[model samples]
Structure formats: C-alpha cells, structure tokens
Target: MPWGERPRWARWVSVIWIVGFVEGTGAHLLDLISGGLHAYHAWPLPSQVLFHALLVVDLLVAVLVARGLPSGPPLGAAVMVTDLTANYQGNWSGLLHEPLAYVGVTGLLPMTLFGLFVVGTALPLGRAFRGIVRPV
Candidate 1:
C-alpha cells in the first residue's frame, strides 16, 4: 500500500507511538541534564551509549512508521523490546521492595502494553483503518 493510503486510525496509532517515543526520550534527556552523567555511572559506559543511540533509532523508526511505511511497527517494536529488556534488568529488583520503586516500575506497564498492542494489531488495525474490518 502507498504511504498516503494508510487508514486514519493507523496513522493515529503511529502518531501516538511517536509521541510516546519522544516523551520517553525527553524524560531521559531531562534526567541526564538534571542529574548529570554521574547519575548513570553505575551503568557501563557502553550500555549507556547504546541505550541513548537506540532511542534515536527508535524515534527515526517511529517517524517512518508514522509516514505509513509498512515495516515501521515491527522495527519500532523490536527497538522497544530491547529497551524494555534493559530496563527490566536494571529495575527488576526494585519491584521487590520500596513502594515508590514499585510504582515507578509499574509505570512502564502501559508502554509495554502499547508496544504489544501495536505489534499484535498492526495488520488488523491497518485493515480497520482502511475500512476493511467493518463494524457489525
């Protein structure tokens, strides 16, 4: 399908995902700016660099996806999964204790859900947006 021919809802989902990606990146950047690099010293330099680099790549993928590229959602989901893996590893223990930490960890649940939703519904949603999946 052509980029301009995508369903409206698919485009909206893509925009939502793009906003989420940008918000996530902005939050991290705010952390870095407010706390300085010392705050992330516990993480290895290479890992830190890789995480930020991936965020940029994710944003780019999101932009492509928002433009109605068929390959965008899967690639975006892949990058999101990588990020979720690293985040889970880093914060898994926090879920065991500390109410504040628990809240913070759970806060990521929505993003995970959104990623899964995008992956699982990509085709159907696309079809629905294109009016192929009509209402009963």
Candidate 2:
C-alpha cells in the first residue's frame, strides 16, 4: 500500500512496534555496557542467557521491522513474552513484598508495558509491517 493508502490502525500499530524495538535496542545495549556480562546476575542461568541474547535480537528485529518485514512482529512478541516470564520469575517474590517496586521505571514496569503492547497489537502490527515500504 502507498504511504497514504494504509489504514490508520496499521500506521499506529507500526509506530508502536518501531518505537518499542528502537528503545529495546538501546536498553539492552546500555545494560551490556554498564554491567558487562553480569547485568542479570540476579536472574537464573537461562534468563541471563536470554537477557544477553536480546542485545542482538532486539537490534535485529528492529532492523527487520524497519524494513517492513512481516516476520518482525511475531519475533518481537516472542521476545517480550519470554522476557516477561523470566523477569516475573526472577523478581516476583521481591516485588510482592514491596508493592511499590512494581512502579519502578527500570524494573518490571517497562517490560510489562511493552509486553502488553506487543500482546495487544501483535497481529495488527504484523499486517502493518507487511504493507510498510522496506527501508533502503
């Protein structure tokens, strides 16, 4: 579809995923830089691996979605869901004791929000991405 031809819903959904991946890329990068390989030291071995893997996966999916590939949204969805699960597993008990911890900006809040966004818009974002013109 032409830029002006795509529906509003598609355009909005596209913005949502694009912004998410772009920010995710930055967050993972910074985590790696500041914490080296031990940023997720609080997490289990598997979660730590997944967290590290996102440093590359987030950028890859961001590029793919920027290029308008239809495959990006599903991959993004998978990343968020898995990350959320791992984060909850790692932090649930601690956060439960301090209810206000859930509101922390760098804590589970952003991940939870983004995961919710991906869950809500995954299908529509996939459709939107397919119609997006691939970035040069």
Best by lDDT: 2
Q: List candidate 1 segments past 4 Å from native.
A: 1-4, 35-39, 44-46, 104-107, 122-136
lDDT score, residue 136, model 2?
Answer: 28
| lDDT (Cα) of model 1 | 0.64
Give, for candidate 2, the lowest lDDT window spanning 10 residues: 127-136
Cα lDDT tens digits for candidate 2, 1-136 = 3435556766676667778877877888898899999988888999999988988888877776666677877988898899899989988898889978589776689879888988777777677656644332
lDDT of 2 at 93: 94
| N/CA/C clash count, model 1 | 0
Candidate 1 clashing pairs, residues 3+ apart or interchain: none
Give the per-residue Cα lDDT of candidate 2 at 55. 80
* Model 1 TM-score, 2 decimals: 0.70
- Tell how far residue 20 is off in model 2, in angstroms: 1.6
